[model samples]
Target: MSGEFDRVARLRAIFAGAHRGVILGIGDDAAILAGDVLATGAVLSTDAAIEDVHFRRAWIGQGVTWRDVAYRAAAAALSDLAAMGAEPRAMLTSWAFPRDVGDDVVDEIARGFRDAADVYGAPVIGGNLARAREIGLTTTVIGAAPARAPRRDGAQAGDVLWATGALGEAALGLAALEAGIAREPDAAAFVSRFVRPPSRIDAGRAAAQSAHAMIDVSDGLLQDLGHLCDASGVGARLDALAPTREADALARRLGVDARALLESGGDDYELLITAAPGVDLSRIAHPIGEITREPGIVGATTARTGFDHFG
Candidate 1:
């Protein structure tokens, strides 16, 4: 057999005896797993960070540091657990790093991981290291949600959709970094967003009890919400008034297209949730819009609102 075919066969053979807890093993975008201990249900989620694509080492010029990247990666993974309305318990990180990177850089990255893990009481249990031309990080997080695990498919018609925290900040942060505007005062807020995104752990947990369906806003509000609608087989009508505060400010200050920024911007990592009609959900933080029955359609009050991955 050819080398490529032989490699596939070898991998399949290696994974053949993987245990029952393995929800999804090799040959998928991510591997899903369950725990050996019995419980209501288990949650498994994964996230990836790549050099140049997700971030650049050069961007940390001068006073900046690589430890920030480690913290961001850990938080990003935990955010997935939060979206499922689960509490993170453990994380397994895999790293690929270049040969030239010093040990101090690696140590700082580890420190970042430790700091973020401490924030949510989740600890890194195990991981693997490998050599590569560029740095890449992949973290798989495991969590548990008492009995009712919130799912992406649970949204219902007439449910209200909401997002926690401000939108487009992370995107704008990236913009600031790209423009080398880090010295500005406003840039600090954006830089904090880019370097350390707040994973809505507490907010997501609270929302889980009331939310019909939920997802973390990692890939921009519009695109991620589209995934929710697709999974739940429903449509959504976005209230233009909801996104106004952030969108308008971002538009005036940075010359960003408010609608496009809110819709398509990624890495906000806030919770995108759907709740039943008249659910008395005002107590929840950052309720953005409502869910409807128009399948495959997301209606925004204003034109040109929403995210397009390819656009």
Candidate 2:
């Protein structure tokens, strides 16, 4: 058999298992998932991670690993479901790599996929493999939708704006890595944020109960918020915006404004939610700002916008 076929066989073995939600899994022409999971609702999202674009191979031995790459790709795709407060059901991964890549590397990537799936209780059901000039992974996640999945356009002028988890950590992490200072003792936290961004599924579910609108902070805070505001036909104002101590110190060391990082840094993977007064989300997120009757965003300086493929 050809090496590619051999690698496929091993991947099938690696991801083999019976999932109650999956009628048929790997080694089949296509996956057959249970209809009950989709009976109430289903949400599907896809994300792509490309070498050099999303990550670098040079960092593999230094800090990034094949496993991290696969995990990050899965997390990115899963975060979409989290934004909609969905329960993960299953996943599909399509891999593109050089012909020279070996079976060992393929196994490591498969393990990464397994680990991420385990965390979200999503099983890998099917995928495709192909040759490409650069290594890339495109992940598609299927999730059981929440009854009241929040939308970006649901915000009201008086709704409170909230955020889950800290901001700017990942931005600083990327900066530290590019500066070759990622190994610095204090850079660990920031670097971890960049390498392994969280998928806030539980938090999303919590917010879905009360939030008028919600979005995952994949792009910079201001950029993604802009999207929400635009969709909701409302504006926003930041009243209390502060960076963590570690983030502040790192920003100073890197000669960048801490506030700027907090405003425009991407990859935090936290949720941004808006809700009416008296709604309690204290357990999942903290108040950051408030929606406004005004038409544009105010209260923070954003020198640059978030990640854009064409921009």
Candidate 3:
């Protein structure tokens, strides 16, 4: 509740009722742009990836190419709209580069942006370029949903929790890269998960049909769950026996417990959803836990919070 949460909370408290015609704002995956598209409002979100903070130079040529960086950056922002079950409309990018960075490298970055934009059918609308001390990239994605996109505050007590895909692979991938073990034979999946995580757009959009509340798991699962809980004014209790989502072989390679990684790793880009009891979610997500009338996550053996910039 300290770092990002506190900052967002302060902003929310100060800006309450400040914006008009916003379908949703401040505490959800993406803010609604107040226009109808497919019977729902348009969604808008922006994300930034700094050269050192979000990524590193070692990975530029190794696990990820420059194009991959642009792709990942776009994917990260688009994931927010995915959480809202929004179909992508268009994207704009703002880039800051060092003075000596060559034009060829810049071209490669452009290629990366173009390639990623093409994937979502989200054109790279024009944006600004400026001189900077390091590589700074920002992506703004717009999307729409037919059914109103899922909201974080819609969960009802007694809803069950579910998620899409496995978790922690990206975290392990980052671990491998940091430990100088990325060159190992089994590192491909890890690197791919880390460098180009899936946005789970389809999964999220499907969940929106039945989910009482939803959020994208950008931080660790625990932290994102807390966001959902806070938004819904509710509590939760996870199943102790909920299966680990990381690959066992990869966990062994990293000398880590797969369950631990699944619980705490960031950047999986999966969906965390809470749906009405008895809702059939088999096709879209895996059952993970249940929501409670009480106000905190209980029954977990280890307490954890997801990645926070200042934690």
Q: Model 2, 241-295: lDDT tens per residue?
A: 8888878988899888878889998888889999998898989899999999897
Cα error, residue 203 of model 3, in Å, equals 1.5
Question: Which wins on lDDT, candidate 1 or candidate 2?
Answer: 2
Candidate 1: residue 201 lDDT (0-100): 81
Q: Identify the runs in model 2 with alpha carbons over 4 angstroms from their true place.
A: none
Write model 3 residue lDDT over 1-311, tens digit each, in one string. Answer: 12335534543443344323345555665455445442455688999999889888777656677877777888888889889987876666777888766655666666766666666656554455677999998988877763666799988889999988877778888888877777677877787787777767778778888889999988888788888998999988887643334367767767876666678788888898898888988898888889898998876655676778887
Models 1 onward score TM values of 0.81, 0.96, 0.83
- Per-residue lDDT tens digits for candidate 1, residues 210-233, read 889988887877778888998999
Error of model 3, residue 245, in angstroms: 9.3
Query: Per-residue error at 60 for model 3, in Å?
Result: 2.4
Return the candidate ranking by lDDT, descending. Answer: 2, 3, 1
Tell me the lDDT of candidate 1: 0.72
What TM-score quantifies how close candidate 2 is to the native fold?
0.96
Cα lDDT, all candidates: 0.72, 0.87, 0.75
Positional deviation of residue 58's Cα in model 2 after best superposition, in angstroms? 0.9
Candidate 3 deviant stretches above 4 angstroms: 1-40, 241-246
